[model samples]
Target: MCFYDEMKGYHWDSVESEIMNRSRDDVEKALTSSSMNLDGLMSLVSPAAEPYLEEMAQRAHQVTQQRFGRVISLFAPLYLSNECTNSCVYCGFNMTNRIDRLTLTAEEALVEARAIRRLGFQHILLVSGEAPHLVTLPYLTSVVDLLRPLFPSISIEIYPMDTSSYEELIKHGVDGLIVYQESYNEDVYKQCHPRGRKSDFHWRLETPDRGGNAGFRRIGLGALLGLANWRVEAFFLALHAQYLLRHFWKSFITISFPRLRPAAGAFEPPCPVSDVQFVQLLAALRLLFPDAGLILSTRESPYLRDHLIPLGITSMSAGSRTEPGGYAHETHAEAQFAVADERPPEIVAEVIRSKGYEAVWKDWDAAFLH
Candidate 1:
């Protein structure tokens, strides 16, 4: 059954009460438990656990080290296009935004890909705006055909597609999929995406299931932190992730925490997550899902990201450019979001090494797929 079916069985009242009314004792019990469950995770992520940040960090660090080791997977985002049809209120690519747009030709994409390869990132995440006509399956397949031979692992972070579309992508060499629900709260979700195909929340929610059925090796889920109450959004994200883990056991799951950043929309966040709470949330997620990958993107500031590395983050984006043709061309499209950590990939790798963690670029390969 899908998570929406489970949502029908749950009452938001109990969930809000469980999180908002959690006591220090509840937090303590969750942290001290020999093994974690949903109840423990709820308590740990609650505000009651704020005071025990150090303890949570220590436990989370231990759990992560036990499962994965002192290694950070490094990757870069290759923006394929910024020509969007969706009117997402929070995104820079909203159709109403007056900005220069770009849809990279296959040659331009290769130019950008070759530059990224020189930066030593063999794993490239191909990103695009949610314009069905502009970024169609055939278009994506051609892009994959152009870069699959150069990059060891290629992933997508574009509009969601059906199982058949994803299967076609897998056939052409797309190795992973990252589809953020944007917000799990249906009311808030509809409010944010008022126009275009993205208005269909249920279809977007089922994209990962479609990806799993298409046999993608890895699938990612996330909620934009500012869309709803961060705590509630995170709780539901954990629930969604756990469901996928149980059902799609073969796919490696990763969760990304993308906080609000400056975009073309220039919309202010209703509730911004503080550095302290961000750390606490990351640690709680790590403790609860020890084997799951926690990704910290360049959206966070350098100081905050530096402190967060060992806390629970397993993967990170370095030297990222959020605009189409951003890396290769000087006259590129406006960025969807400005990157906070401007450090080049080499500098980021050195930082990882200085912390005694190995920087991994290609631990995955297509050879095993056959």
Candidate 2:
């Protein structure tokens, strides 16, 4: 069964009750447990856990060090195109927007890839607006084949597709697949993606499952926080991650927390998660799933990102450009969203080193695929 099947039994209303009702005693009891369960996770995400920030962070840091060591895996996002058909209200690439659109040819993408490589990013995530007709499977295959020789890790944060398409991408050397649910609240999700194939919420929800079935070694999951109550979104997100872990045991499942950032649409996160609460949520996830990888992006501020590295963030992006063909071009197209941390790769790496941690640019070699 797809994750949707497993998820269908639960609803947001019920989950909201469990998390919101967690009391201070619940948080204390959950934190004291030697091994955390889903209830423990819910307690950690509770508002009651806010005052226990220091205790949570201390435990989260210890858990991370034990599981991942003092290493920060690094990567970059290379936006291939900003041409999208979806009318996602929170995005700059919404179809109704009046902006210049461009999809790079394979040659142009190579130039961008080489530029990214120069910045010491061996891992690259190719991003595009959901314009499948413009960014077809064959188009993506050629681009992946081109960069397969340059970068060791190539991930995609684009439109979702069937298992066959994911298998095809793997054949051409794409290993990492990152897809966000945007919001787990079904009603809000439908309203957020009013039109286009993205409007099919279950299909988007099952994307990582499809990717896992197609044998992707790394399958990334996340929620676009701010769409609904972060606690509600995070509970379902943790549930999804847990489901993937149980069913797809061989796959390395990753979780990312992409809070809403400003875009051309002037949209805002309805229930904005404060920085302290965001940190609390991260610590909760770390404590609950000690082995899972947590990825942070340039969507966060430099000060916050730096503060968060030691807390529980295992991987991060630096010197990221969210526009199509942004790396090589001086005049870039409109960005999907404005980036918060704009430090270059070297500087970010320097900052990581200053914390007495190693910033790793490359973690996977193709030989491991065997």
Best candidate according to TM-score: 2
In terms of lDDT, model 2 sits at: 0.91
Candidate 2 lDDT tens digits, 203-290: 9999998998998888999988788999878888888999999888989988999998999989987889899989988999999889
Model 2 spans with C-alpha error above 4 angstroms: none
The TM-score of candidate 1 is: 0.98
* Candidate 1: Cα lDDT at 217: 88
Instruction: Score candidate 1 by lDDT.
Output: 0.88
lDDT of 1 by residue, 201-282 (tens): 9999989989999998899989898877788777888888888898899999999999998787788888788888888789
Question: Model 1, stretches more than 4 Å misplaced?
Answer: none
lDDT of each: 0.88, 0.91
Q: Which candidate number maximizes lDDT?
A: 2
Clashing pairs in 2: none
TM per candidate:
0.98, 0.98
